[model samples]
Target: MKQNLLGAIYLSLAASMWGGMYVISKYVLDFVPPLTLVWLRYIIAFVVLFAILKWLERKNENRAPIQKRDWFLLVWIGFIGYFASIALQFIGTKLSDAHTGSLITSATPAFIVFFARFLLKEKLTLRKICSVTLATIGVMTVIGWNINVGTYFWGSIILVGAAVTWALLSVYVKIASERFSSLTITTYAVLFALIFTTPFMLWELQSKDITYESSYVILGVLYLGIVSTAAAFFLWNKGLELMDAGIGSLFFFFQPLVGSFLGWLLLHEKLTFHFFIGGALILAGVLIVTLPTKSVENE
Candidate 1:
């Protein structure tokens, strides 16, 4: 019970960081191109995570290094996760509202549940199904039923792409965790992501000039890099290792909650009835997924 509680806290913290990240990324995107910003974020995160890994290794000489076979998995995860998904998120959010990005990516837990079945061979129980269904309904309610495909069509599509890739990353991370430590996986995966993103960052720089509105933009970038990418990623992976992937993924709904709250607070967006209603449903869904019933425990 204590471990599960700790896992919930870690996942919640990670989700909150990512939720608040949209606002920071939106501001920073004014100065930095999407691919360039992603590259820079990974670069900063990689350096910090690598330094920590090195320090830890020095302290504990007995820890085993990652095997040769796992390199491919790490690289693949880096490519799909940080390089593709996060870049899509930046581009999507730049083109759409932060609330839209949060709502759309809120569907990630559903995809995680789906992928978990095949990838992790996790049983698809009725409670898990209902949890995902309820959360998805809540997301739709929060975002509204009206479709404006003519205006932000591509942005919505891109955000969906981001959600799918991120879900894939989560499931794969669980698979990888069976063999590798979370810190090792996160550091190396981010290093590979940085390597993959460099060329794209350079290409983006060819036509785009980065200009900061204020020194505060630097702070935003630092927060995105160190806190969001480095620390939050570690926390998220650690949380996943401590709990079932589906249960762990239920914490993702916290992203939309935090994102919506921050969006209202910082951007002065209105808090409507839908927000409260949807938020409640989302919370209920999370409780359903995380609070293991007698049947779930037996499974």
Candidate 2:
């Protein structure tokens, strides 16, 4: 129970941290290219995670061997969580409005619940379903789904793909806990994500037409990699390992609200009133799903 509590706190902190990254990221985008930013961010995150793991190696020295079955799971999570989701998100924000990008990404909890049902065979609880429905309504309100401003070809698809990837990763983590330590799985995932993203990072640096004049870009990269990616994922997976998929995902609903506020506070971005209302609904929906209630019993 103690481990579970720690994990839950870690997950909430991780979720909040990830949510805050948006505000910072929007500021960085002006001076950085998407690919370059991703490259630098991952490099830093990789080093930080490895360093922390190594630093704590003394504690885990007598740890049991990781099961062979879990190795595949870790690699898969690396692909989805760290690389695919992170890269696409960075690119999507760069390609589209940060506001729109966040709205799309907020769809994650809904997707997670869906995937969890089929992939992990998690029971479809009413609270989770209601939470998903409320979040959808909130998202629709947030984005004004009526407003379509983009290449109108593949950009939206790519953004959706990023959300789906993260959702899948969430489900994978839920399933993987049955077989491995949450930290171990997350550790391997980040480690392998770095491995998978490294060559691409190098290749991207070589080929991309990018701006590299400002220190803010470098700072942003370091921040993204070290704080946002490395520390955040570790805590997040730990939380997920400890909590239920529906219950744990309640925190994810906080990302857009945090991101939007950060974008407003730091990036000087404007927020529509509708967005505030949408955000409120999302939170309300998440609450509806995760709250321990007699309503569930009454209904």
Candidate 3:
């Protein structure tokens, strides 16, 4: 029970940070291109994570040596989840509209549930199904149904691919947690991601103009690298470590809810009736999965 509570807290915090990330990214992207910004974020995150990992080790929390299979798994997490999924998201959003990207990628939790069932052999309960349904509906309400499918067919497809890859990353992170500490997993996985993203960042630098003169851009990059990437990623991995992947996935609904709120707050975007309605439903869905149930206790 205590573990579940901690997991819930961690997941919620992680999702909330990511929700705020959209606002920060919007501000920072004005100066840095998407891929270049991502690369810098990873580099900063890797440094911070690696330092903490070393500090923990010195405090006698030494990690086990990773096996060859696990190394491959970590690389897969980095490549598919961090590099490929994020790249696809940027490209897809560029091609399509931001609304379509948000709407499509909101399906990530559903995909995570599916992958958890197959890969982790987790049982799919009625409660899980209901939670996902309600949350997905809430996301649709929040984002609206204004999809430009005819014009952005390929972008939509790529967004779907991004969703799938991220789901796979979540499930695999769960699998890896059996053998590794969340800190170790996150640190090493991010290292691999940084390596994979370097070439793309260099290529992007050639074509894109970067504004390094603005203090706002610098601060935004620092916030994204430290708060959103390092802390949020660790919290997410730790949360999944302590809970069922399917249940943890439901917490992802908080991202859109918080993002909408932050958009209104920071960006001065307008809030509508749909936002409140959708936020309530999303909260309810999370509670349905997160609260302890009699059946769950018995199991």
Of the candidates shown, which would achieve the greatest TM-score relative to the real structure?
3
- RMSD values, in order shown: 2.2, 3.0, 1.4
Q: lDDT at 125 for candidate 2?
A: 82
* Model 1 whole-model lDDT (C-alpha atoms): 0.85
Candidate 3 TM-score over all chains jointly: 0.97
The TM-score ranking, best first, is 3, 1, 2
TM-score of each: 0.92, 0.85, 0.97
For model 2 the local lDDT of residue 145 reads: 72
Residue 21, model 1: lDDT of 88
Pick the winner on lDDT between candidates 1 and 2: 1
TM-score of 2: 0.85
Q: Assess the local accuracy of residue 296 in candidate 1 as a C-alpha lDDT between 0 and 100.
A: 45
lDDT ranking, high to low: 3, 1, 2
In the range 1-299, model 3's lDDT, one tens digit per residue, is 89999999999999999999999998888889988899889999999999998988888744577888889999998898888889899989888989999999999999999999999999898889999999999999988878887889999999999999999999999999999889988999899999999998999889998988778889999999999999999999999999999999999989999999999998999999999888888888888878887776432
lDDT, candidate 2, at 90: 69
Between prediction 1 and prediction 3, which has the larger TM-score?
Answer: 3
